[model samples]
Target chain A: MRRDRSIIKNEKSLRTYITPPADLYETPDAYILYIDLPGVTKENLNIKVVDNSLIVQGKFELSLPKDSDTMFSELAKGEYRREFVLAGDVDRNKIDAKLVNGVLILTLGKKEESKEIEIKIE
Target chain B: MTLVRWSPLRDLATEIFDLQREINKMFDRFFRGFEEEEEVRISTWSPRVDISETDDEYIVRAEIPGVSKDDVKVTIRDNVLTISGEKKQEKETKNENFHRIERVYGSFTRSFTLPGAVKVDKVEAKFKDGVLTIKLPKVEEAKTKEIEVKVG
Candidate 1:
């Protein structure tokens, strides 16, 4: 291995994954999670629910012209991972997910037993 | 008062303490996203960016997910390149019960002076997949030139 290649390997070892920013909201019907995942195509994303937690992971490679030379680079291109513990009332089977413009939106529905029941005066 | 002698061990302990605090702060930022705005002069949620130089143009890319195309604006004036945008929250606070509010929503502006003269008219900006790419074509004189030297 060459010297510069070793340096690149060291940099890769320093960071194996990034935790993308996420917005989590709860409504009467469900808990919604919106995560930023730029440069990731829809097919490249992987989402799973296990151990009472919601996990989202995606892999992305930066697309740049072959002739271009990076002068200043702050963005990291690699695997993105985020895990959120699901609430006790959430129904994993009712969860729905969608990808819009590189944003992963996950809706975890609340179980019927968890919703509040309104009472009216007779 | 008598001068106190320096303690190297104590200094090392303090240094490690400071490093631990810094690492904790970075983890907080990574998991929780942006902090609440406290200052009006500058915002803390600026998007990360990358710039590359091609033969004819400079490619500038920024990661700004969840922002609409209409909300973002790009402009070049007085040799300064500016990219500004707002990521608005559409939550109906009255109806929804939020378990958490970690996503940042507010106006953000980033600007920088161009290192070399570029064709303002030829500049192109594209926003897709939550990433903004700006291509600034360099002027003919600003492009790199190479001269070959005869072998000795």
Candidate 2:
């Protein structure tokens, strides 16, 4: 997959949120990040990698009906932002991402120099 | 063999974030009363819901994303409607290195008491795009009736 090289500038000025839940997992060759961004469409998500941190942000647009009444309000509707610090073991060029059903999945491939090599005895 | 309770999500990294959010929520609630609505709005960890009533039906909408259809259940018995289900974690990965866990995962139940008798057979429920919509049709007597007044 082609890498996302266009950096999103001046987006940090907007008010951010800390609610969307995230999970990270690592494999032998890569690390995966899953972010729950419900109600956010693919067009509203922004994924960026700067220096040593990977940032994922999403915006949600939900409007209630004019005649509706909110009996219960729990889920906060706003931007969902999360950042992960890459520890130099990740391959910046090989990173990839996809959003399915409002869940953003980011995979950061491990650097070839960081993978463990099994030694063989003659 | 004896076992020790282990939870990686309970580590210090997540606790600090949770603490910060608590502080922010407190401040929001403190200033919320200044609005025109005198009643304070409370936010919880559960899914948000909206309930509306029309002449023929009462509609309920809930925002519960990322949950599959099989995991959710809706039932009504004795005029008490209940939506209960489990929010399970994503399937196991090769080796998960969790950083933050903000989404709640567990079995949750939200029940609502119907104000008037509804036609149980006519109730219809639909789940789409992680939102659940339930339509409860009101009985004949439960609907409002308009009467004209004679002029003096």
Candidate 3:
């Protein structure tokens, strides 16, 4: 029966989607993002890149028994949506998305010209 | 003003209380700036859970993303249901440069006292997509019953 302030705040926004927590990492050639979306499956997940922004949306429904009453609740139900602004050097066409263990992994590859290359002197 | 006698014991108690308050304030100030970093180092986070009940059974669901099924454990004792698990971070990211990190990783435990007796042997649990669902069937005596009456 532990009550967290963030859970109570999320309950107030039940009608809207929750902003899932995320992590961002930068490698030599790509930027990777991981978003936690528990209970979301591949079928209900949507990812798209529009302009320079990457939008991610996922919906999950918990099916309960008929005529059931919720005794205690802290888990957020409904949709999850998050958007990130892509950098200018990111190659939109090379972006990849994967859903693994309820986490959405997005890899935004850098453009060919943006990647660092060793210069040779004669 | 009436003259009051000063007791050494009371004076010592007051001094100790003042010292305790000052120490607490100092610790608060010291930890306030590094709360996030401290959380990352400790890595203990509780997963959100939902519990529901119907006429015959109770259902519990917990959101534990990035945790493997083998890492989770469920148990019931003394009418208390407990779910515990550890969420491991990806190994490859250990040395990577992280631009931002908001997701939590570590062990967590949550327990709830059951409202009614349940058939402990009939409990079923399933894990999928990082959500753990538990179904606990209530005992025969604990099931709710509805009655209908005829109108005259």
lDDT of 2 by residue, A1-122 (tens): 12334333335445657566777777778887777877777787888998899988878776555665444455566777877789789999999987755567788999999987888998
lDDT of each: 0.80, 0.71, 0.83
Each model's TM-score for chain A is 0.82, 0.82, 0.82
Report how far off residue B70 is in candidate 2 (Å). Answer: 1.3
Ranked by lDDT, the better of candidates 1 and 2 is 1
The alpha-carbon deviation from the true structure for residue B96 of candidate 1, after best TM-score superposition, in angstroms, is 7.5
**RMSD of each predicted structure:** 10.9, 11.7, 11.5
Question: How much lDDT does candidate 3 score?
Answer: 0.83
Model 3: per-residue Cα lDDT at residue A96: 92
In model 3 chain A, which range of ten residues has the least summed lDDT?
A1-10
Best model number under DockQ? 3
TM-score, prediction 1: 0.74
Query: Please, what are the lDDT tens digits per residue for candidate 1 over residues B1-152?
Result: 99989999999999998999897788556534222122322755787788888889889998887788999999888777788888777566675576666667788877766767899999999988888999999999988899799899
Interface RMSD of each: 5.4, 5.0, 6.2
DockQ of each: 0.35, 0.21, 0.41
Q: Which docking class does model 1 fall in?
A: acceptable
TM per model? 0.74, 0.66, 0.75
Runs off by more than 4 Å, candidate 3: A1-15, A118-122, B1-43, B91-96, B146-152
Clashes within 3 Å, all models in order: 0, 2, 0
